[model samples]
Target: MTELLSLSRAARLAGVTRAEIQKRIRHGEMQTFEGQVAISDLLRVYPSVSLEQSGDFERVEQIKAEAYPRSHDEDTRLPSQQVLITRIKALAEALVQRVARVEALEQLLEEVRARLDEMAADAGDKSGASAAAETQTHTQAQALRDLSAWLQTRRTDLAESAVEAAQTQLLARDSFLRIMSASVKMIPSGHEFFVDGNESILEAAVRSGLRLSYGCASGNCGECKARLVSGEVYRLREHDYVLSEREKQMGYLLTCSHTAVTDLQLEAAEAHSPADLPEQEIQAQIRKLEPQSGGLMLLHVQTPRTNTLRFMAGQRARLRLADGPEQELPIASCPCNGRNLLFTLRQGDDAFSQAVFETVTPRQPVTLTGPYGDFVLADATEPAVFIALGDGIAPIKSLIEHAVSIDSIEAFHLYWSVPAPRMHDHQPWCRALRETLDNFAFTPLVDAACDDLLALLESDLEALPDNRYYIAGPGSAVQAVVSTLLAAGVPQARIASEELD
Candidate 1:
């Protein structure tokens, strides 16, 4: 039996469109096994199939071709051949016309030379030839002037031809701009214009001096994604083959591919660059490093000089490990604790982890910088749901503690997930939640044994009665969870999620 691959993955591997892949499956050209198609079937029948082997090789080649086809000799040669044939035909016709014109000019020059030689022979036989010599000199001067005039006419024609060529190039450029401008719309909201209409949002924004949230602009990366409140968007190119049907229906546009058809209202949920963030350095002592279940370590750092280090909860800081270089990490603790700074670190016994455990003793000096990330607890009175996975628990933990301290949050729920072993080790944090929080619920998933987290929430969503949801996790996991939540009827406006990377 052949291993199955998703339709999107198969499309990527087969160098065909996802729509094409689906068509093939429907047409019985390829067979779908499980939620994916058999690689063998795709290899056997894909029109552009080059690789006999399976796995990601076919997709890799497709991507390379798309990115750099010019580097391939065969690809370069084909286009060059067509262009060469067209140029050769044009040059051949021009050369033939020039040759015929030159032949006619040569015959006319021969007639003039023959007439001059006859005149010279007549002058040679003259008895008093001074007057004849003067007449011949005048004739020769007249012929030289005629030749100069002819050369000037040819030069004028060449100049005119050069000007016409330049005008053609200018017109071509103008046409390109007009075509591109039609697909792009520029909207000015306040001092800054919100450019949402263009499919190439980043390119448009950058051209206009507006910075957008993007990591890899390629569609596969999902870095430049945005919610389109109202508009029709078309995808040009995508890096990743996966885009859920529900996301499309809900008007969630990947800014990379989304060109605006109608005027749009977009709420960008991305972090401001580090240059925009306030910079500060703080001295703190590592008071305790308690092991938490699920490979999470609860770090309590004491800053006695300052009762509280003013920083954002989801913001990260740099901790100079005792042996290794400084490690930059985000703050996990809620802002409620003034003097004691709390943070959580995911452990794997890596160099940084080893330095924290073996080298850095409690009460050791540590330097922290940040209150970074734009992920913050919104100042809304409405109840919200906080969903977190893996180390993503850090930000949710901060927001929750802050809400409880301010008495601003009336209702909220926290969902945290990690491996079973890590969960077991960090049971105390869960115990603390069970003991302290009255209105909140802490439901931790041992592993990703479940299909969807939002589905689990839907079973009791009505009970919580909160419309807002904040989510953070690894890029892929975050995308899966967000798609699942949106599919479950959560509005795009109500859902806030961030991928740290």
Candidate 2:
């Protein structure tokens, strides 16, 4: 019997990103059966894969420790008791079925061996047989006995096969993982994310950088309603929003109130374009206002718990002060944390800048609206070149964080041009990123021109022609980088840019 593993599970067992597994499949290095990889094939490709090396056991222990006293607690890292029970029941049923099948196969094998023995005994009892015929019957009987022995030996070998044992361990860990968390696959868009801990489907979706349409993070609105295409989900909390009888019969569930009981396929609304996202107005409180070098201010704000802002990474938002001033700036934080938002602001003669720098304090209420701009990442699993000139790092920062959250980007190379003071402030971050992400590289330039930037990227052009390019800064700087990339044989469709000034 061959065990087929989902792409995500195969990646986990192989200790690589899912994108890496997909890349192998695309390059003909690995094969998939019905979008799932065979465990045998996985082992053949990733020979070094081991239970310990996969870190699955450690993860199990960690999640258990994190969710200790793991009953119905919603604040912990384990699913609710009801969800856990349902998953265990499902696994138990599957196990029983497999056991029954094994027993039936054993019985069939015994019957076949008995028939072979009968045939051999009958051949030997042919007393009237000629000498030549008797010799031929004896040879046939010997061959039949040998065949039976070979079949028994083969069965024993398979029962104790090292590959089979390894796969069994992998399956055990995977089952535990499934009980702890359920993977959600979105339809139409084909987006996928894991629902870990006790997080509702909506929460997990948002944390995974998915721009699913929702009116409220709470369960009061039915905007988060999605059809359960397959798999099981249990209600973690009751919702006030009532679904129609027809909708309920058709498997509709409120994502904000339900927890997945098994891996799920959901027909949910997701935003793939700027137009897909609706304009939202949120009254957010200032959380922190810290001044950094190069006259830049880091303004942090937290939205009301029930009404978080909905936006994609690398997008801009319009911030308005009560009876003061307003400004439109690129968000500097990833969309994973919709309630908590960060913006990079340069102190300028603008009224909004002055108000934010001098008057804004913690707890100040600000009206935020219009999550604008289409400057977001496009190929989630591609190597990317990010060019940030001056304050363009703001949006670029969000893009980088979003890519990190997605956990599928093959590689990241950032080329940032800023003043000496700004570069000094950015070095620690760049160094930290390099130290953490093995595939990340950074180049900081002080007062560099288009020619210098182009020269620095020449090697990358030769090495990564498929790399997606993102340029952000002053309009002129963005234009210069775009032209340089285009002149270097990069397709225009592969390049995206945003002007910060």
Candidate 3:
């Protein structure tokens, strides 16, 4: 039996009005028994609800001490757009040196040719009396040919070596920081990563093998959300995701969407080693495809039992078919059934997927490489909230099934949102989950209400302050929900997010 609290006590604990509490109940965000609210549920929804939001400077300071970042503003920026400028500068220098050498050699060659002409003319006039001059002219012509061959070789070498490390300093052509002029030094832990104006901080970190939680590598997924503790930063591109006003006040920005302007002293989740999930290159066969309501196809893949893939739930892999380029898609199946894999492919203009959907048939050869992504279930036993947008439901479904199978969780809620009400085709699986699990609930947010996911969530789940939120959606929608959570004062580490294409 779950513990229950009265509406007044719940409101008091959450520091909100009774009407607000009622709204949560009506939206199914709050669970109750005979009209009484669950205390655990209240705590899960309002981790910071007990903290006085009206406190003075000292109180706010105390809260800051307990949280991640110590400050928000007071920072500097980097020299933006250094990569392009660096390349141009390198090319210009190479061209200048090459041109100078070529011009000097041409002048020298012309002088040599003119002297030989004079020697030949003198030899012709003096006949037998100037044999020595004729011999000197032949020697000069031979030397000129040698010099011309040398110049040609040298020019080829210079052009070929122009883009290599010799021209661009020690860093090679593809080096992530090769063109960067500014460096970002993180505070407290002191891990440093370099960034050019063109690359986002997240991209630079990844290239440097420093992991800051990121997904989509676009502005829409707020997974790379971090505070600018004290560095000037500039936007690389306008982000698709919306940020809450509170979040902006807190100096939160997506590492994938911003570049450091100054030598940055930053505050972010410390870069850490990724989990060791053994990776392999395997050949699999396409088994089947089932059409779903959202113009999606449930793709089934099977590999030989001897070469069964090892992957955690909620992880994705890249698939390559025949000779086409590889396409990255999430694994939509549990490891419990290790030999077979499931993935959801949205029908659209993507040539790779369309090729597989329309032309490919069963038993066709496919290649898989991965078990990438760190969006799997956390080690904690906290109740979880899953919000899925469109085909983002794939991984969430994997998580739900696997979590239950592993006894990792029982009670969890899913908010499944689609483009419209007509695309709500996942009710059967949700019903099956409810029947199987001891505690499970699925809520579909479809129709026009699904159009603005942030607004829908803000109006419905604003009271949930503490549950571990696992969100997967288009980058913009994920960012919006994350911004909403951040504005509500949820801890950053508790919000796990990934971006869907």
- TM-score for each candidate, following the candidate numbering: 0.42, 0.91, 0.44
Candidate 1 minimal-lDDT segment of 10 residues: 68-77
Candidate 2 per-residue lDDT over residues 1-501, each given as its tens digit: 778977866776677767668778877988988778998888888877765655542442343233122212358577778888999998888789988999999999989988888888887778788899999999998888888888888889988999878788777777777778888889977778888878888888887778888877678988998999999988877889999999999999999889888889999778888888889999888889989977889998888878888888899999999866999999988787788788888899999999988988899899999799999989557788999899898899889878866766777899989855564455676776766565679988887898888788886555546788888999987898888878878889889999877
Model 1: per-residue lDDT, tens digit, 1-501? 244555544554454444456556666777776547765565467533433333443443333223211211222211133333433454456558867986787677667666655665554455555787867765665665566556656656855784444433333332222222322232322112222222255444432223355544456556566666644344544557365788767656667555433224554543334354345566778998887555567787776431234454455667765444566666776543324666777666567776775576788877766656667766554666887877777777666655543333445677777755555333455556545444557777766633556567877578433568888878788888877766666778777776865
Best of the candidates, TM-score: 2
Measure candidate 1: CA RMSD.
27.1
Model 3 poorest ten-residue lDDT run: 67-76
Best by lDDT: 2
Against the true structure, candidate 1 has what lDDT?
A: 0.55
The best-first sequence of candidates by TM-score reads 2, 3, 1
Instruction: Give per-residue lDDT, candidate 3, residue 392.
Output: 83
Residue 183, model 1: lDDT of 26
Candidate 3 lDDT tens digits, 269-309: 75332265556678888888787765778888887643555
Model 2: lDDT equals 0.81
